[model samples]
Target chain A: MMDFINFYLVPGITLGAIYALGAVGVSMIFGILRFAHFAHGDLMTVGAYFGLSAVWLLGIPALAAIPIAVALTCLVALFADRAFYKPLRQLPTIYTVIASFGVALIFRSVVQLVWGTESQVYSVGFQKPIVLFDSLRIATRHIQIILATAAITLGLHWFLHHTQMGKTMRAVSDDPALASVAGLDPEKTIRWTWIIGAGLAAIAGVFVGLDTDVHTMMGWNLLLPMFAAALLGGIGKPLGAIAGGLIIGIAEEICTYPFFGESLISPSYKSAIAFVIMLLILIFRPRGLFKGRLL
Target chain B: MELSGILFYLISFLIMGGIYSVICLALNMQWGFGGLFNAGIAGFYAVGAYSAAIITSANTPNHVGGFDLPIVVGLVVAGTLSGIVGWAIARICVRLKADYLAMASIGIAEIIRLAVINEEWLTNGSLGVSRIPRPLEEFFTGRESEMVFFVFVWIIVAITFWVAHRLYKSPWGRVMRAIRDNEAAAESVGKDVQSFRTQSFVIGAIFMGVAGALSAHYFKFFSPDATEPLLITFLAWVMLIAGGSGNNKGAVAGALIIWAIWSMTEIITQQLPPDWATRSSYIRMLLIGLFLQFVLQRFRAGLFPEKAPKLNVKSHG
Candidate 1:
C-alpha cells in the first residue's frame, strides 16, 4: 500500500496541483474572455522559461526566482492580448479562438527559437526523497508544488470573494452587459483578468519545471490535460478546476498501474487517459461537474 | 534555376497544394456552413493515411501489410472509417458549444496520433509504414510520374470541389447553414440541428480522409509525424480562412498561395546560418501566426466571403 501510495498517489497529487494552477487560469479566462484561450499552454511555457531566465541571470534559488518570473509573464500575457487578441475582440468568438491558436504557435516557436530544443533544470542536483511514513517518500519539489499551489489557490479564492477588482472580474464573466450597466470598467476588469490568469499560469509553469525539466514541448504536452481539467471542473469555476485537475492527474497516473498488466498500458497512454476521462465527463454532463455556465 | 528544376518544383507544389485544398474545402464545409470547429483534422488524416497504407502497401517483415488491395478500395475504406469516427465524435460533442468541439477534436487527434505511435503492429512504430503503392506507377516514371500524380491530384480535387459545391447549394445545405446562423430558429422550423451538424461533419471528415490517403500514396511513406497538428490541422484552418470560407474556389486558391509562400519561406530559410537555419521553421510558424492575426484583424471575411445563395423565388399570384 505504501509503495503504491508513494509511487502513484503522491506524484499524481503533485501533478494535479500543477494542473490546478493552469486550469484555474483557463477557467478565469473562459469566464471573462469567453474563449478557450488556446495559447494558454504556450503562455505556461513562456512563464517557465521566464523563471529559468531568472535563475540563470540572477543565480537565485528556484523558489526565489518565481515572483519575477510571474511578473514578467503577466506582462507578456498582457502584451499578447493587446497585440493579437484585442483587435479581434469585436469579431465572432471563433475568430478569437483561431487567433489564440496563432498566438500559441507564435509563443511556442519563440520558446524554441530562444531556448533551443534542449531541456533545462532550475537547480541541477538530485535530492533524496524525504520519508513521510513507513516506506512512503516524497520529493522536496513535490512538497513545494503542493504548498505553493495551496497558497495560490487560497489567495485566488480570497481575492475573488473579498476584493472589488475580483468582484468586477467575476461580474464581467457573469455578464459583461450587466457589469457595464453597473458602471464597472470592463477594460480594467479584463486587464486584471489577464494579470491573475497569467500570474497563476506562471506559477504552474514554474512548478512543472521544478518537478521535471523545462522543455519547449513541456507546456504543449500539458495543454490537453489542463483543458480537460478546466472542462471537467466547469469552465468558469476556479474551485472546480482544482478538483478537475486532481481527478485528471490521478486518473492519468493510475492508468499505468500494474493492474493493467505490464506493457499492456504504457505510461505514454497517460495523456490519452486524461482525455478519455474528460470526454466521458463531457458526454454525460455537458455543463461539467460543477454546473458552470454552458458556454 | 534550370527550366526542368523549376517545372519539377512547380509540379510538386501543385500536388501538395491539391492535397491541402481538399482539406481546406472540408474545413470550409464544417466551419463555413456548419459553424463546427474541428481541431483534429490531422488525426482523421492520419487514420486515412495509416488505413490506406495498410490496405495498399505490399507485405513487409515485422509489420502488418500484405493485402495489396486496389488504390480505390483503400481510399473508400479510409473515407468510410474516418467518417464513422467523425460521426461518433460529433454525436457526443456536437451537443455542447462549438468551442468544446475544438477541444474534443484535439483530444481525438492526440489519441489517434498516440495510437499510431504505440500500436507498432499497424503503424510500424517509428519506422513508419512505407512503400505505399502509387496509382498509375507502372506507366508513369521519372518526371512523368510527377506529372501524372499532379494531374491525378487535381482531378480528385476538382471532383471533390464540384461535389461539395453541389452539396452546399442544395436545399439540405441551406438548412445546415440556417442551423449554423441561428440554431433556435432552425430548431423551431422542425429541422434537426444536431443531425444536420453530424452529417456535415461526417462528410467533411470523409474528404479529409480521402485527402490523407491521396497524400500517403504520393509520398509513399507515413509516420506519426504526418499527423502533426500544427503542420496539418492549423495550416488547413489558415488556408481555409485566408482563402475565404464558404467559397470552394477560394479554398483552392488559398491552398496554392499559402503553399507557395510556405515553400518560399523554407527556401529562404535554407540560406541562413546553420544554427539559425535549425530554428527557421519556428520563425516561419511565428510569421504564419502573425499573418493569421493580420488577416483576422484586417479582413475577417477572408479574401472571398461565401457567395450569397441565389434563392429561386417564383412570382406566384
Candidate 2:
C-alpha cells in the first residue's frame, strides 16, 4: 500500500493538480469565448518559458517567477484574441478554432526559437523526498504543486461566487446575449476570461516545469488531457473542471500501475488513456458530466 | 543554378505539387462540400503510407509483410484501410459540432500516430518502412525514372480532379450544398445529413489515403517524419484555404502555389549560419502560421472563389 501510494497515487495527484489548473482555463474559454482555444496549451508553454526567463535573468526561484509568467501569458492571450479571434467573431466558430490552431504553432515555434528545442530543468538535480506519516514518501515539489493548486482552487471559488466581476464572468459565459442585454460589456468579460484562463495555464505550466524538465512539446502534449478533463467535468463549469481534471490526471497515472503483479498498461501507451476516456464521454455523455451548454 | 540542377528541382517540385493537389482536393470534399473540419489529415495520410509500404516492399526481417505485391494493390489496400478507419471515426464523431469534430478528428489522428510509432512489428517504429518499390521503378533509372514517376503522380492528380468536378455537377453535390448551407433545412427536406457527411468523410479519407500512398511511393520510403502535421495536415489546410475552399481548381492551384512558396523559402533559410540551422526551420513554420492568419483575415474566399455548380436540368415550378 505504501509502495502504491509512493509510486502511483502521489504522482497521479500531482499530475491531476496540473491538469486541473489547465482545464480551468480551457473550460472557462470554451464557455465564454465559445471556441476551443487550441492555442491555450501553447499559452502554458509561454508561461513556463517566461518563468524560465525570470529564473535566468532575475536569479529568482521558479516559484517566485509565477507573477511574471502569469502576467505575460495573459498578455499573449489578450493580444491573440484581439488580433486573431475578435475579427472572426461574426464568422463561424470554426474560423476561430482554425486560427487558434495556427496560433498554437506560432507560439510553439517562437518558444523553440528562443529557448532551443532541448529540454531544461527549472532547478538543477533532484531533491530527496520527505517521509510523511512514517510510511509515505513525497517530494517537496509535489507538495508545493498540490498545495498551490488547492489554494488557487479555493481562491477561484471565492472570486467566482463573491466578486462582482466573477459573477459577471459567469453570467457572460452562461449566456452572452442575456448578459449583454443586462448591460454587461462583452469585451470586458472576454478580457477577464483571457486573463484568468491564461493566468491559471501559466501556473499549471510552471508546475509541470517544476515536476519535470520543461520542453517545447510539454504543454502541447498535456493539452489533450486538459481538454479531456474540461469535457469530463463539463464545459462552463469551473468547479466541475477541477473535478474532471483530477479524475483524468489520476486515471492516466494510475492506469499504468501494477495491479495484478504486472502493470495494467504499458507506460508507452499511457497517453491513449485520456483519448479513450474522452471518446467514451463524447459518445455517451456528449453534454458532459455536469451537463454544460451543448455548444 | 546549373540547368540540370534546376531540372531536377523542377521535377521534384511538380511531383510533390501533384501529390499535395490530391490531398488538397480530398480536404475540399470534406471541408468544402461536407462542411466537415478534418484537422487530422496526417492520420489518414499515415495509414496510407504505412499500409502501402507494408504491402509492396520486398521481404525483410525487420518488419511485417513485405508482400512484394503490385503497387496498385498496395494503393487499393491503403485506401480501403484508411476508408474503414474514416468510416469508424465518422460514425462516432459525425454528429458533433464543427469545432468538436475538428478536435476529435485531430485526436484520432494523434492516436493513429501513436499506433504507428508503438506497433513496431507493423510499422518498424521510428526507423520506418524501407525498400518500398515505386511504380514502374523497375523500368527506368536516374532522372528518367523520376520523370516517369512524376507523370504517374500527375495522372493520379488528374483523376482526383475529375472526380471532384464530377461530384460538383452531380445531384448528390446539390444536396450536400444544401446541407452545408443549412443543415436543418436539408434535414427537413428529407436529406440524411449524417449519412451524407459520413459518405463524404469516407470518400475524402480514401483519397487522402491515396495521396499518402503516392507520397510514400514518390520518396520510395515511409516514416513518421513524412507524416508531420506541420508538413501534411497544416500545409494541406493552408493550401485549401489559400486556393479557395469550395473550388476544385482552387484546391489544385493552392497546392501548387503554397508548395512553391514552401519549397523556395528553403533556399533563403538555408543561407543562415550553421548555428542558426535549427532556428531557421522554426522561423519557416512561424512564417507559415503568420501567413495562415493573414489569409484567414484578408482572403476569405481565396483566389478562386467557389462558383455555383451549373444545373443541367430546369426544375419545373
Candidate 3:
C-alpha cells in the first residue's frame, strides 16, 4: 500500500495536473476556434523552453519561472493565431488544423535550433523525497506542482464564473449564432481563448520540465494524453478537462503498477493507454463526457 | 557525381518515388475522393511493411518469421492486413466529423507505433526483421535486381494509378464525390455514404500496404524507422496537396517533386559543419513545414488543380 501510494498514486496525480493544464487549452481552442489545434502541444513545449531560458539566464528556480513561461507562450499563441490561423478563418476548419500541424513543426524546429536535440535539466541532480505520515513519500517538487495546478484550476473557475470576458467566451462557445445576435465579438472571445489556453499550457509545460528533463519531443509525446483528457472531460468545459486530465494521468501511472505481482502493461506502452481511452470515448460518446457540441 | 553512380541513384529515387506515388494515390482516394481525414497513413504503412517482412523472411529466432512465403504472397497479405485495419477504424469513425476523425487517426497511428516498438516477438522491436528477400532474387545478381525491382514497382504504380483513375470516373466514384462535397445532401439522395466511404478508405489502404510491401522488397530489409510518419504520412500529404488533391496525375507529380526536394535537401544538410550535423534534420523539417505553408497559402488548388471530366451534352437541333 505504501509502495502504491508513493510510487504510483503520487506520480499519477502530478502527471494528471500537468495534463489538465494542457487539456484546458486544447478543449478551449476546440470549442472556440472550432478545430483540434494540433499545435497546442507545441505551445506547451514553447512554454517549458521559455521557463528553461529564464532559469538559465536569471538563475531563478524552475517553479519561479512559471510567469515568464506563461507570458511568452501566450505571446506565441496569439501571434500564431493572428498570422497563421486568422487568415484561414473564412475557410474550412480543416485548413486551420493543417496549418496548426505546420505550426507545430515550426515551433519544434525553432526550439531544437535554439536548445539543441539533447535533453537538459533546469538544475541537475536529484532532490530528496519528503516523508508524510511516516509512510508516504513524495518529492518536494511534486508537491509544488500539484498545489500550483490546484490553485490555477481554482482561479480558472473563478474567472469563468465571475469575469465578463470569461462569460462572453462561454456564450460564444455555447452558441455562436446566438452570441453573435447578442453582440458578442467572436474575435475578442478568440483572443481570450488563446490567452487562457496558452497561459495554462505554459504552466503545464514548466511543471513537466521540473518533473523530468526538458527536451524537444516532451510536448509532442504528451500531446495524445492531453488530447485524450480534453475529449474525456468534454470539450469547452475547463472543469471537465481538469477531471479528465486527472483521470488519464492517474490511469497512465497506475496501469504500469505491479498489481497482482504483474504490471498491467509495460511502461513503454504507457502513452497507448491515453490513445485507447480517446478511441473509446470517440466511438461511444463523441459529444464527450460534458455534452460538447458534435462538430 | 559519376554517370554510373547517378544512374543507380536515379533508380533508387524513382523506386522510392513509385512507392510514395502509390501511398499518395491511396490518400487521394481517401482525402481527394472520399473526404476522409486519415492522418495515420504511417499506421497502415507500418502494418504493410511489417507484414511483408515477416511473411517473406526465412526462419529466424529473433522474432516471428520462418513463413518463407514468396514476395508476392507477402505483398498480398500486407494489403489484406492493412485493409482490415482500415475497415475497422473506418467502421468506428464513419459518423465522426472530419476534424474529429483526423484527431482520432493520429491517435490510432501513435498506438500502432507503440505496438511496433514494444512487441518484440512479433516485430523484433527496434532491431527489425532482416534477410527479407527481393522479388526474384535468384534470377538476378546485386544491382541488376534493383533494376528489375524498379520495373516491378512502376508496374505496380501504373496498376494503382489505373485503379484510382477508373474509380474516379465510375458511378461509385461519382457518389463518393457527392458525399465529399456534401454528406447530408448525399444521404438525403439515398446514397449509402457510410459504405462508400468505408470502401474508399479500405481500397486506399490496400494500395498503401502494397506500396509498403514494395518498399520492403526494394530494400530487402525492413524496420520500424522505415515507416516514420514524417517520411510516409506527412510527405504523402504534402505531395497530394502540392500536386493537386483530386487529381491522380497531380499525386504522382507531387510525389516526384517532393521526393526530389527531400533528397536534395539531405545533400545540402550534409554539407553543414560537423557540430551542426544533429540539428540538420530539424532544419529540413522546418523547411518542409514552411513549404507546406507556402503551398497552403499561395496555391490552394495545388500545382495542378483538379480538372473534373467534361460532362457530355447533346445540342437540341
In candidate 1 chain B, where is summed lDDT lowest over 10 consecutive residues? B59-68
User: Which sections of candidate 2 miss by over 4 Å?
Assistant: B313-317
Residues A1-295 of candidate 3 have per-residue lDDT tens digits of: 9999899999999999999999999998898888888888888999999999999999999989989998999999999898889988998888888888888888999999888878888998889999989998999999999998899989999999999998998888788899999999889899999999999999998888899988988888888898899989988888889999999999999999999899999899898889888889988987788887667
By DockQ, the candidates rank as 1, 2, 3
lDDT (C-alpha, whole model) for all candidates: 0.88, 0.90, 0.89
lDDT of 3 by residue, B226-294 (tens): 878778888898899999999999999999999999999888878989877678888888889888888
State candidate 2's TM-score. 0.98
- What is the alpha-carbon lDDT of model 2 when measured against the actual structure? 0.90
> Interface RMSD in Å per candidate, to 1 decimal?
1.0, 1.0, 1.3
Worst 10 residues of 2 chain B by lDDT: B97-106
Task: Please state the error at residue B185 of candidate 2 in Å.
Answer: 1.5
> By how many angstroms RMSD does model 2 differ from the true structure?
1.3
Q: What is the TM-score of candidate 3?
A: 0.98
For model 1, how big is the CA root-mean-square deviation? 1.5
